[model samples]
Target: MIAYYVHHQGSGHVHRASSIAAQARTPVVGLSGRPRPAGWTGDWVDLPDDSDGVDASSRDVTAGGTLHWVPRRHAGLAERMRRVSETVARASLVVVDVSVEVALLARLHGVPVVVVAQPGERTDRPHRTAYDLAERILAPWPVRPAGGWPDGWTAKTVHLGALSRFDAHPAPAAGDPCRVLVLWGRGGIDVGPDRIAAAAAATPGHRWVVAGPHPGPGAWPANLTWLGWVDDVWAELSAAGVVVTHAGQNALAEVAAARRPAVVVPQRRPFGEQDATAAALARAGIAEPTGSWPEPAAWPALLARAAQRGGTGWDAWSTGTGAARAAALLDGLAA
Candidate 1:
């Protein structure tokens, strides 16, 4: 059995976990705090049911083979550690995305773990330390030639490329001009409607779609279409010619996987992780950086440049042959 432990802090980890669970032939179980994506076969814990409101603050729920919760802040360290230990005990193998506690628990259980991340320069230190405890560390993008993990760690660290959720989904219908899809996370602080409206107005020839968990009312322009969280963001992703989005690790990879070039605007919040994500993509020559948000007039030319640059087919490194090989390695450990 494969146990997927997701922190639910970002949609990227859940997206990554969904891809892994979908590919696993074994009985896959998921533990997450975020709302589970549709069509995922595994039993998931703490996933919200349809009756649940999007704004509900209920921090914890469990169903299927997963456990989901927002950890209490006042809990003692020992008690929190005990709870994590219990969760780890139930799984033979633990697969985590960028969770430090997950690594600690997996180590206690002697359960091999696969740590998935696209590390930026800032978190490199903690990430490396976490990697020390992991059985294998999976990098979701192509590896740079220098200043990476040491050779002793090389045997365990694998650049599995970017994981794309659209690989199996049917494509969405083509829209007028080229549809530009802009997506943000649950927080409105990072990406606001102003950028979306401006982008739509600046690129008069193109249609713009905004997606995320619905942030309450704002003045939406006629050119911008507000598409709240849909079951098939991937469908929209497939149909988009230009994706203007935040520097979400999974989002960037998904854009690359679709073979479309994108203009990425890094988020300034939560410690500038988006900037790190954008930096790597920019360095890779796969993405054009627009800081937090770019001006609408700037997008037309950037979109044109992205169209010319095209996608680098990074999906093969994560979900394709790379995942297959990683699975084999994991199975060997499970054996």
Candidate 2:
């Protein structure tokens, strides 16, 4: 059996894990702090939240600043580690999506590990340590010579080219009034309510749909529709004339798969992850980037430029077979 460790930070990690697991040839088991998503066929272990039960006045959550987190005297952390150890004991391969401590632990237990690589400035000691210990590194983008990856790291790395849950889903038919879908991710976008309203007002003829966790400040324009959180993202994408989104990997992959033009706004991320992905997209001429949120006045020109691009160079990034390719790699490792 193959074991997968899904990070609990955001939905992206779990979403990517589920997509890849669905394509796995061997039986897959998942462990995460988040509850198992519906339709997950694999065995799941819901780990207790490590941050829970911590006495802030007394507990040191950082484990002496050596690890990202290992709460002091926390039963959840102990139980979580015990479960991971148990899983590693029986599994042939451990796929981490990702955590340095977990990868190290798996390696120390003698189980081969495949670590997921994200676009970022990840040359720090902890990241480097994990990369060094991993048997293989899986990158979900097309092969690129950038990101300043350390020497010898690429030899064991496989580029799977943008995995998405909607790879097999049909694209939505184009809608009238040129619907522009504005997507905000889990962490929220930097653009404020005034800017979003200004953009809606500036683009009079088009329909602007705002989706994801951003509620915006109070009321919105008549032309703009706010969808707090959506389960049917593909429907929105299909109906869109253009997509305006944060440069999150999964979101970008989905947009590319739908063959829609996009304006990618790079939200601040640790290790410059979003910025790196946005830069690569701009360099490839796949999407237009606003280094920060663009001014309301700049919306007309920016959207026009993005529409002109129209998913021209995105084929290189969104092959729609990434999950299959990633599954094959994992199966090979298990064999």
Candidate 3:
């Protein structure tokens, strides 16, 4: 059996976990604060939220801010660690996607750990410590050129380009009036309603659709329609002539799968993760990236440029078999 630790922050971690776990030959067990997703057949162990009983005055959340997060005197934290300890004792390999504390715990318990690598400035002590201790580092994107990763850390790393649930979905035909899908994740975009409305008004010919949590307040223009959060992300991407989204790993990979051009507006993330991801996409000619949100007046040119690209260079990022590739790696480790 293999143990998989899914971070309960955004849906991305769990989504990625589910994709890879489905391809695993061995029975996979999941540990997370989030509930087991619909299609997962694996045994699940629900972990309590560590942030639930945090007390700054009484308990130490971090070991002097050196470790990522370890709430001192936290019952939930203690229980979660205990569960992990118990699981690792029975499992042959542990996959973390990801938490530094969990990675350390698994390693200390004498279990080999595969740590998921996120795109960002991960030169910090906590990140470095986890990377150093990991038996393998799984990068979701294609192997980036030199200078992006930490020194000597890429040797044990396996670059599995953009794992997405919809990689096998056929590219959707372009819709009339040029449908534009705007995706927002849990982190939410920095773009405001006024700007979105202004952009909609400026491009009256195209239909603008906003999806995901927190679409912002106020009424939208007639051309702009808010879908809020929808279960079918691929449907929206398929119908879109172009997509405007944050530079999140899952979102980017999904866009690549749909074979649609995108205007990437990176939201603020730890260590400028989104910024780094957007830069890579732009360099690869996969997407048009604006360091920040583009002005409403600049939308016309930006969208036009994105549409012209037509998501031609995205196959390198969306291999369509990344899940199988990652699963094969786990199978090898388990063996």
Candidate 4:
């Protein structure tokens, strides 16, 4: 059995794990602080929330920069690792989607660990230690960046391309010529609703639809409709002429799967994670990336440029077989 540890900070980790689990021939039990998602394939273990009622940042969470999130006095942290250690005893391999501490725990137990590589500037001690310990590093992007990682780790990694739940879903034929879609994750976005409204106003010829919750309560612009947390977002996503979204890997992968060109405004994230992704997508010419949203007046040209780029190149990022490939790797390891 493969024990998958999913980080609870963002939905990306869980979404990626679920996609791979769906295709896994081997039993893949999920371990997370969050509850089991609606269609999880195998047993789901609820790991203790380490940050419950605690100021994680204010305390000595990092062990003086040698590691990440090992709070000194947190009972929840202790219990979380204890449960993970129990799982390690029964698992053939552990897939860390990611947490350095959990990787270390599994490695200490002599279980082979495959780490899900995150896109960011991960050149720190804890990250290096985790990478060194992993039997394989699975990168979810098509191309590993040019520099930073040593040769050994670069060779050890398997580039899985972008994995998304939507990869298997066929993108519907293009819908309205004047549709622009926005996707906001439950993980808070740095971009404001007013700014989105401004962009919508700037492009009155295009109708803007937001598929996630409105960040704040407010009346929307004439052309912009806030469809808060729609049950089926693929409809809006697949039909849009252009998708305006953040640079989170899952969001990007979903957009890629739908074959929709995107105007990517990378939100602020730790270690400049989104920045790295935005740069890669921009270089690939599949998405138009900006450090931040441009003025309202600039939205028209940006949207036009993004739509003109089309989404043919998106398959370069999401090959529609990433999940299957990852599952095959896990199955092989289990065997």
Q: Deviation in angstroms for 245 in model 4?
A: 0.4
Candidate 3 segments exceeding 4 Å error: 53-59, 146-151, 214-217
Query: 1 or 2: which has the higher TM-score?
Result: 2
Return whichever of 3 and 4 wins on lDDT: 4
- lDDT for residue 242 in candidate 1, whole number 0-100: 73
lDDT of the candidates, in the order given: 0.64, 0.84, 0.86, 0.88
- What is the clash count of model 3? 0
Query: TM-score for each prediction?
Result: 0.78, 0.94, 0.95, 0.97
Determine which window of 10 residues in candidate 3 has minimal summed lDDT. Answer: 168-177
Clashes of each: 7, 1, 0, 0
Q: Candidate 3's residue-wise lDDT over 1-335, tens digit each?
A: 99999998777888899999999999999999999998999999999878885776566666887787887877888898999899988989999998999999999989999999989888788988889988899999998873656666889999999988887677677644288998878655677767777888888888999887545656778899878889898878888888999999988888888878899999888888898999998888888999987777798888899998878688888888899999999999988
How far out, in Å, is residue 181 in model 1?
1.7
Pick out the ten consecutive residues of candidate 2 with the lowest summed lDDT: 169-178
Alpha carbon lDDT of residue 274, candidate 2? 95
Lowest-sum lDDT 10-residue window in model 4: 212-221
lDDT (tens digit, per residue) of candidate 1 on 29-75: 77665766787887776522222333224433222213222233424
Off by over 4 Å in 2: 53-65, 170-177, 214-217
Candidate 2 local lDDT, 238-321, one digit each (tens): 888899999999888888778788999998888899999998887887889879887777888888888877775778888889
Worst 10 residues of 1 by lDDT: 61-70
Candidate RMSDs in Å, in order, are 6.6, 2.0, 1.7, 1.3
Instruction: Quote the positional error of residue 267 for candidate 2 in Å.
Output: 0.7
Sorting all predicted structures by lDDT, with the top scorer first, yields 4, 3, 2, 1
